[model samples]
Target: MNEITSHQCNLNIWAHLPDKVWNRVANIYELMPGWIGYIDGIPHWFGQEEDDVYIQASVEPSGLSFYAQMNQSDWDSWIGAFKLEATKVLGFEVGEPEDGFE
Candidate 1:
């Protein structure tokens, strides 16, 4: 059976951005061509219904909180894009996603 794995982190840099910027960053995945909306608010890709991959994020006082369950390739792609988007939109250097959760 497929097991759901998770990773969480504090995106401290995100705390400094304005609401508009934050919204833009948060919606990056949603704007992508393959993203599909789910009531659960977890991030996922279209045509991936048969896979167990999933992701979710939220704004926190320190920064942003991100969680995802996916394979290595998916995690690398998704997390890389997320960092890139955050850096581009926020106009700052985003840090690497620390392995595991705090």
Candidate 2:
């Protein structure tokens, strides 16, 4: 048997963001590649199954968190693109708290 590892990161956005802000975020997700759909208000990508190599986003107390079963290079590129889009669309910089976002 083999073990699978999941990589995770958080963006510096509030969990209880306004509906309008969430709507904009949803639009950004929809425009991105591999966006399957939202399940239970969480955005999923590639596939929505447990065994799939996919990306999932959830609202957490600290911020919006992303979990993925993907290669490090791919994950970096995807997350970087998301941050770029978010910064452009949301009118503010979006990044991890550890990355000096705030």
Candidate 3:
């Protein structure tokens, strides 16, 4: 048997954004690779395995956070791209709250 480890990251996006705005975000998710649609209202992604690196949009007190479990390089690239697209499309800065995105 073997053990697998995963990394995680989050994006501090407000969960209460208007439907119109969320609709735009949905469009962005649609274009992203490995998007598996919303499962139980949370966006899900196909990982390397049934239990490997993956991504999920989870609603938390702070906001709609992105929980990603992938290699550092891939996570970095994917999150960067997502942040760029989200910032451009949403017309607001999208980033980790810890990064000063309050």
Candidate 4:
């Protein structure tokens, strides 16, 4: 998780993204003051910079699951909006995004 940095916030959010990607992005996400979320039920964290990007996977899980990465330029508010949308899609009580990148 130490590979993420201010420069690598624009990570891939799909299931096929390479493991090295999250391994790098998570470092920055871990260091930043951001939030924790579940994109399509996969755990994720926002990256450095305001509305920078959200990285939604890691190397530990090994194989792929579902992921929903947004465009780096997309409004964070839009991503924030996904919680409610995802809940409806996922049919679970998708909780408010948690602020955990403390």
Top candidate by TM-score: 2
- Which candidate ranks first by lDDT, i.e. highest? 2
Candidate 3 Cα errors over 4 Å, as ranges: 1-5
Question: Candidate 3 residues 2-98, lDDT tens each?
Answer: 2334655566677777898888888888778788887767787765236677888766777767776776677677778888998999999988887
Count clashing residue pairs per candidate: 1, 0, 0, 3
**Order of models, best TM-score first:** 2, 3, 1, 4
Ordered by lDDT, highest first, the candidates read 2, 3, 1, 4
Candidate 4 has its poorest 10 consecutive residues by lDDT at 3-12
Higher-scoring candidate on TM-score, 1 or 2: 2
Tens-place lDDT digits, model 2, residues 32-90: 87898988878998766575478999888879899988767777778889999999998
lDDT, residue 28, model 4: 38
lDDT of 4 by residue, 72-92 (tens): 334344444544444344334
Worst ten-residue run, lDDT, model 1? 93-102
Model 4 gets an lDDT of 0.39
Output the TM-score of candidate 2. Answer: 0.87
> Residue 73: error of model 4 in Å?
10
TM-scores for candidates 1 onward, in order:
0.63, 0.87, 0.81, 0.25
